[model samples]
Target: MFINMASPERPVSNGKRDMEIDKYGFTGGDQYTFPGVPGELPAETVRKRETKWLVMLDNWNIWMAKRFPQLKKRCRKGIPSSLRGRAWQLLCGSRPLEAQSNQSFQDLVSSTIPETATEDIEKDLHRQFPFHEMFCQRGGAGQQDLRDVLHAYVAYNPKDGYCQGQAPVAAVLLMHMPAKDAFWCMTAILTYYISGYYSQGLEVIQVDGLIMQSLLRKVCPLAHKHMEKLNISPMLYCTEWFMCIFARTLPWPSVLRLWDMFFCEGVKVLFRCGLVLLRASLGNVASLPIIPDTYETMEKLRKLDKNDMHPEFLMHAIITLRITENDLENEHRLQMKITKKKGNSSVKLVKRVYRYAPTLQHHGIVQKTGATKHLSSVSVDSSQVAKQTQATLPQKDKLHNDAVTLTVYRPISQSSITTLSSSHTSNQQSEGPNKDFQLKNDVDQAKGTYL
Candidate 1:
């Protein structure tokens, strides 16, 4: 399963063909040369590193068999770069090449005709890793490989199409493994780790931001309060962090460590990492050179040096954080409910806008009950406004019965207003605060951690 590229003379093969696996992988016939490179790995260096890799892989298998916790603890230390590709495959449970043929991917790429997504895929190709040599040159081997992987994915799932954030993710994957393996890893990320993230509406990413906001309030109340007072939405800074899995924000080494834990643990790692970043930045953000806007804040976050984010320190801090798996599950549940309710309202609004708005604008009256009736005022209740506002809030704040004030600047018809007020009264009477905001368990859990 191991392809030795220790010596230039050693011809690497994938069993089916005689190929030399270069830094990226086998590129048909060429040696796949880079701009500035060494002749070959020193014999001693190769032996030492490869021996360590083999021994580590063997130990991983043994621990995996026993379902031991030590394996995770060891993985937290970091996977060696030499074995990172294979280790990632093992983590995601990817099948061997012999069992899963590449012919299918080849055929799909060759046979599938370019459709609507062709333009999108082409535009994002060079934008992936412009600084890196592999992807620097236009139409270079790396860029071509990136295009193939993305196009194949587009054909694989046409409905989802192509998303911008996925390019960097795929590019990082390509750095570690071949195109096919990278494609599978991308699939695993989309399907299992972060479902609905790239889908239309990006519903999951939005919910995750709200969840982060909720967690931040508990983890760093002062920082959260500062951000809230400043009117900084979680969507401002966290969108890129969540969408790209911190690929665009953190240093490469730190991102690798986070990914290592993410694959082993799950989405909870992302929450922990977000909390860590905010916690680290709390003092700096609270004082001196105060962040001006979202752009400056994000730029400052991205520029955080390795000293501020040493892998061992960050990982240790993340593990020791009060956040837990159950907390994430509860936040996810709360966010899902809120997102669904909003989604339904949006759908209804879209339907109404398209079907009735144009006609309403043109004519002042409408036919109702087989008679022409003049449009009247729309009345909204005070309590109804409170319910709507509370629903949009995070779970932590939704339970409090805070009085809300609503201002209406525009005129509304009396009939519509009465109908709205009646509906609100009925809703207020029928639904209790506990039904929508019953989160005693979450409150108790947060108290245990926050106190």
Candidate 2:
């Protein structure tokens, strides 16, 4: 049993699993056992990444069909390791950023040399998915390179500054690209698909969420309810996901899959992906032993596997959602309805204000619109002032100016003229009232003049 020194027929260890290889190469012990060691960053994962990346590439539509005849098959199966960077660039529609015509890529990269970037990049440097081995190096090259590129990008787009969610997405990109190319690709992603999800003021992101919610309510009422029930509102989870394009939640390969679709489809694809996730988990969600809470809802949704994520079905659902009966009917019916009600109310209001316009005419105040609306009865000082103006101004002139000024004045508060002439004015002076007028006209007029 211990004759290894002389024996040619000794058993040897196979690479990953601890299976045996006898004199002849054959896996003998538990052929499929996992290794004791945790996984490491593999040497050449580009092919796998490419194949996954292509899943989202989709058929040639208006944007990609003719030029990308080969994109479909090429991305799905895999890409060669060395070629992945170039392939990924083409896939994400960053062809423009990486365009041979990229007049400013180096200019932009050179601009990243500022001292401010060194600190910001350093802050996010180790913070991004540092636990992953590819991101680690004794020399710290992995993290260093990624941070440098993204920091360059933040310097690159001063408008965006640096957001927390962009790092993981940047790391994934760095895996397959040089720093500059990765930075530009990130640019394309934020500019195109991210909408306003990561903006500095975050108002665009707020509007984008409203848009997403409107889209969701139209397409997936059940999933929308689940989110509302758990208060796992889009505001919470989506901030990071949309900001980073699901980089943290999805594996790198899946991230590629999502981006391929995003590049081809647009922001609408994100909502479709949401629907797909919900549909995928609908069964688990429905079958849950208890009414699902927020975490429960997400856990169920998280269980979604791409195994049966039929792209065709998802695409159909997204495109069809726009063609609604209400949306198609007469096109302007809703606008007309709102306009008609507004019009009728204005007529009644003008008549009421005309009755009071004469009384206020001495003050050079006049009511505008089909009916007139003098100052509300509550503010006697303002009403008296209005009356004095109406009296000084000619009758015709006061009405005309009232129409013009009110058109540009405080928004009409009540839908009806009745409320306009009523005692609705509160005496409390409004905050910033003077500032608003200052901004309204670049040229300030004399206090009492009608010019």
Candidate 3:
């Protein structure tokens, strides 16, 4: 029997026949249905873009070198869905890690994870993208692939382990690439693009939130004062937006467009996108009838006008804000300085127990208790680079050391998905601000800078 996973409606049955469902939630029967009207951008225009991207992608090494500025400019417009996997791999510099990491993923997925981590991953599998056909099944291929990605990630970076926001990010990567490639892309995103986001204490994530609040005040002072009046904190809405890279906040197309620029331009895109949302939602946030619940205010962001949520509109709004790359860099430095001072004031404690991967024997899973790992490698920015650093774990309750097993029958859902469009919107499809993407001839020629 086939079930319609996209909607909550009941399944229709034909007692004499077997029902089959396709990925987009359509029945496999050969019935023709009229398509919805095309958006402002026509199909031919999108196809032309897809062709242009594919040509550049086919010659990536040369294209990225000679036309780095061009690639950046086009990526701001958005990547075509068909070319997104390759485009992202190129943008994030994940290709070199693919061969090495694919073997690592294979080795880890076949082995047992810490009983706790395994339970956590299984619980989140269906919840990652329940509405999408790929993950709706109880133990379907999508869930299994999602499980493999999360499990491999924990094994690869046990220090970071599995965090709540990582699931949605992983799920989106899987939608574009093979599981192994997705793993590499996700690794680069965490370590290089947004370091400390998923780390314990989430200090960097909080710091980024402060930076957003600073930007909000400058670009939309009225909204900023209003939020301050009501005690609306950036952590309340901005954490999920940054942690998941806006996956839960914007529509799928908009998310892709933001990602395209994010990979090319780095974390600044996230800040720009966050500021745009705060500015757009100013009235909704300010006019709250009473003290607001965090989720209630967030739901307001989730339900932004379809037009405003469109990637083109959001990007236009983002570019109009007069913040510069230097402005963000200065703010980031200040936030980091404040964060380090705060960290120094607190006592650092280490937990003797490794809660994620120690005991498979007790669960009747025949893995050795003596399984050891070399320190998992991660790439950090040059300034913060160190010869060696141990994972800074937070002080936790002793109860976590106790042995316990769990059975996760139902998949736990993650955050909500936005309905914004980043695809095929001619109005929002123009190149970003000219100055932001302009390439200097000297810098372009400089070694290690172009790539």
Candidate 4:
């Protein structure tokens, strides 16, 4: 149902829906506002996405939780097929509001300047179940909806600009939702669910593979070991599953059903689902026995599309797979402990020994040493100085500070020289008494250990 935004002065459309609008009253990107309730069309006019099943390991969820006690209780149930889009939108917290709902997304999409729209959308556009009516229906309202949703997201987060994988997500959403509705879901998925993933630069999306590997290590150590032996991490096998949320890798219905769990649960669902796959294929992975090269391991795993991964069957496989509670808690606790330990270690190592490392030159360490008394003083640097003591310290330890120069300070006597110049001789004789006294004092200071 649509929320009615129109006041009495605003005219509602009385004719059938079409591509263009007669009234600028509801026109956007112009100097006007529309009068009418932005209501949802009746259910009769809406369409369903094309879907099929591949994996059917029945009772997979129950089996997984039972096998591994570490899994959290899913308070939220999976969304029904009919409401998957709405549920996903709700899950991502990206739904549109009445006053300003979807306006920014729509405005941004309309204004985006793409380098080449045809190749960008076309390359992966038809690849996603092109035979399906919902996605393949060219120039149809359905296609427009998918385009709007995808384009809006690309515009909203231009950094991730656009990628080939998003089509399947949008196409899948379109099959089950309106363009605007799917846009809301896309925002939620991109913002809250996979916020960093779809950016043009793909830095965050790439980072996720790293995080997934960490999770794998905890949940399935043995499986993780096998992957590491191959020197392959989640970067190798899991990127596509995440990129499309398993649209291409898993069957359509299987993905939709999985998404139901995903929206209700969040990303942990993806991890748990992945665990099921690893456990089910453990025998296959071990038998293949590949390792030490990430690409090689990946090549072996890519052949995992067994072509018969039905939902019920995977459900069955996961249910039977053995995962333990001790394993889950130990995994989570291990990561949490490591995180805390690293934070503490950094503070200790960077702690200041003196008031400032650079400001030490201004302190008493340099000014008090006797010139002849093994006179090496610590150069206090003040930059690393701490506020508590405000002390400047030398770079080396206390023992080395004074002993460095004592070994070279032996005084040599001036040899008796008979210069024939009488005037210069008198000048030298006058300065000799004061110079001798200074040298004697310096020598005495060194003998007395006055440093």
lDDT of 3 by residue, 150-196 (tens): 88888888888888788888988988888988888888677556766
For model 2, the stretches where C-alpha displacement exceeds 4 angstroms are 1-83, 91-95, 98-120, 282-285, 288-291, 298-451
lDDT of 3 at 399: 18
- After superposition on all C-alphas, the RMSD of every candidate to the true structure, in Å, is 20.1, 23.3, 17.2, 29.5
List the candidate numbers ranked by lDDT, top first.
Answer: 3, 1, 2, 4
Stretches of candidate 1 off by over 4 Å are 1-53, 56-61, 96-103, 111-114, 283-289, 292-299, 337-451
Q: What are the models' TM-scores? A: 0.63, 0.50, 0.67, 0.50
Error of 3 at 339 (Å): 5.8
Supply candidate 2's per-residue lDDT for 198: 54
lDDT of 1 by residue, 104-156 (tens): 66765665745667787788776664545567679998888888888877777
What value does the lDDT take at residue 401 in candidate 2? 30
Best candidate, TM-score:
3
- The segments of candidate 3 whose C-alpha lies over 4 angstroms from its true place after superposition are 1-40, 99-103, 283-299, 336-451
Query: Distance (Å) between predicted and true CA of 73, model 4?
Result: 8.8
- Candidate No. with top lDDT: 3
- Model 1, TM vs. native: 0.63
How would you encode candidate 2's per-residue C-alpha lDDT over 385-427 as one tens digit per residue? 3444444344444233333221111111111112223212212
Candidate 2: lDDT of 364? 24
Q: Which candidate, 2 or 3, would have the higher TM-score against the true structure?
A: 3
Clashes of each: 8, 23, 4, 62
Report the Cα lDDT for candidate 3: 0.56
